[model samples]
Target chain A: MDRIPILKIGAALLVTIQVDLHDSVAMALEEDLSNMIVKAGAKGVLIDISALEIVDSFIGRMLANIAGVARMLDADTVVVGMRPAVAITLVELGLSLPGVKTALNAERGMALIQRRVAESGLEADHAAGEF
Target chain B: MRIRQIVRAAALEAGLSLVDQTKIITAASELARNTLDHGGGGHASIERLQEGGRRGVRIVFEDTGPGIPDVDAALRPGFTTGRGMGLGLSGARQLSNEFSIATEVGRGTRVTIARWK
Candidate 1:
């Protein structure tokens, strides 16, 4: 089973997807991200899909599920780096990914997560201070 | 994923635009997964088409599993008999320039889609 790496950056977890994911791999990623959110007490989740060439309905559903799960666990998810063609195709494929937030790139995605975390009033220092 | 790669290569070989390549590849992925999950596994093939100086790419997915009983209902968005988003068949239809499906109750199902450059 192949696993996509998830790096804990600041108060969020960053996932840079650099491969075309198989169905099983995408499911695994969703499960792993859920566990990581609870384990790391993550405030946000950022998935970078700039390297991916397509976002099929399966992958689109996976993204929506991840966001739903993260929200239930008190975390936010932001998907970043969708190629122009992929974005156009996604809409045509009838997948708007209703609940998933997206940004143009990873840098901006991280900033969006940080802002959300800040607005949520979850003090990063306090969370770190307790540990 | 391999199916998608083959579709992408075929689309490019047929001179599809970047967005068109993505469209066909994505549509192929959706249909291929449907064959595996709902049809109990199948095969996909890519076809390069040419007619009157027009070039295009066509993909065919065939499965021998339990065929869809209600294709009209299945083609409706948000209709699913499996654990999917119910967008595979309809979404694939939307992403392609030409689409067709042939199926029987217990026989099998064949879906073909084409995109012209």
Candidate 2:
């Protein structure tokens, strides 16, 4: 079975989607990510999708779903490396990806996630509870 | 599956912007899925073309299933006969430079879309 690897980097969980994901794979990712965030007690999540060739509405929805679940689990998600064409296409697809945060690249995304975590007092909550 | 791969390769080979390549590939994915789930499985074709000195790519998807009974409604966003967000058709049109669809009630459906460089 094809599986997207999840790497634990200090206080954050980084997921680099490097393959063309089947719909089933995408769903599996959503479930896996949600579980990882809780098990790892991660404060931030950085999803690198620069290698993705497509962000069709389905994929677009999956991204939003991840962001939503991550937030509920007390993890900040910063999606990075979105190609401009994918951005334009997503809007055209009527998906503004509300509630999802985005960054230009992995570095920027990591920084953004950290900054968001700091601003929202996420780190303190991590000690107070399993985030 | 194979159709999406072909479309992705063709879109990239056209030297389109990374974003544009993604857009076409996304559109291809949605349309191809529609062909399979709704059209009961079919075939799709792609063409790299140069018309009026402008280079572009075209993707055509055909399926012989229960054709759409109301195309006008289907073209509108959020109108789906199947379980979907109803953004596939409308979203594809938004991503392409040109979009057209033809279907017969008892026959099949054909959708063509092209993006220029």
Candidate 3:
């Protein structure tokens, strides 16, 4: 089975997953992603999904769970690169996902994370000065 | 399998934050499997949307198979008509910003969900 790829980029982590959008694999992937978030201690996450052709209810639920786990770990997450057709299909099916952040592409997502990190650093610096 | 993969892909593509994408995909995968297992194999649709100025992904699962008789009961969190864990419908709903179901006894079932971006 082709599994999703997980990588650490700077303080963030990138998960590149290629999925058939079918059955048991989807379930396993969900579990894997959740575990990665908990174990990796990443400051952020980027998921690349340009290869998927379908979206179903089970997968939707899993994604939501992964997001929840990432949050608990104090890491931000971003989804990138979706096909338009698949997007429409998911909407028509009435599937919903929660606790996930979205971006247009990986580059943009990474940049967003960088900016977030910078902002946080600035906040910390200011607090230090005050102290 | 296919549905789960697709959910993961879509979640990532939608630029969902890592934590958000994981949770949404997990919940979506469960619901997609339920659609196939109980509904006799159906196709799921996904879309990215912006509502009230908030961006998110929208997913729909449609099946021509036997529809649910009691949607309310089915969504009761612990309710299950099958042997697996009963968290499919309820969990999906909890993971998304909006979840709705439309079904007819002899017709079919349609589930609509919106997870804001």
How many residue pairs clash in all the candidates, one count each? 0, 1, 89
Please list, in the order the candidates appear, how each scores on TM-score for chain B only: 0.97, 0.94, 0.89
Error of 3 at A22 (Å): 5.9
Which candidate achieves the best lDDT against the true structure? Answer: 1
- Candidate 3 — which residues are off by over 4 angstroms? A21-31, A122-131, B1-32, B39-117
- Per-prediction DockQ comes to 0.84, 0.71, 0.09
lDDT of 2 by residue, B26-109 (tens): 888889878887899887889997768777789999999888999989889888887667788888888888899999987889
TM-score of chain A of each: 0.90, 0.85, 0.75
Model 1 DockQ vs. reference: 0.84
Q: Second chain of candidate 2: TM-score?
A: 0.94
Off by over 4 Å in 1: A124-131
Q: Which parts of model 2 have CA positions greater than 4 angstroms off?
A: A120-131, B8-19, B50-52, B81-83
Predicted candidate 3 versus true structure: per-residue lDDT over A87-106, tens digit per residue: 65455445545677878899
- List the lowest-lDDT window of 10 residues for candidate 2 chain A: A122-131
Per-residue lDDT tens digits for candidate 1, residues A78-114, read 9999999999998887788978999998899878877
Taking the tens digit of each residue's C-alpha lDDT, what string does model 2 give over A1-131? 68788987656789998877787898888899899998978877888988876777677777878889998998888889987777777877787877788889988877776676677776675445433
Question: What TM-score would every model get versus the actual structure?
Answer: 0.94, 0.85, 0.52
Error of 2 at A114 (Å): 2.4
Q: What lDDT score goes with residue B93 in model 2? A: 85
B6: Cα error in model 1, Å: 1.5
RMSD of 3: 11.5
Per-residue accuracy of model 3 over B13-107 as CA lDDT, tens digit each: 77776556655775677667777778887878988776676677888989988999999998876588885446678767876778899999878
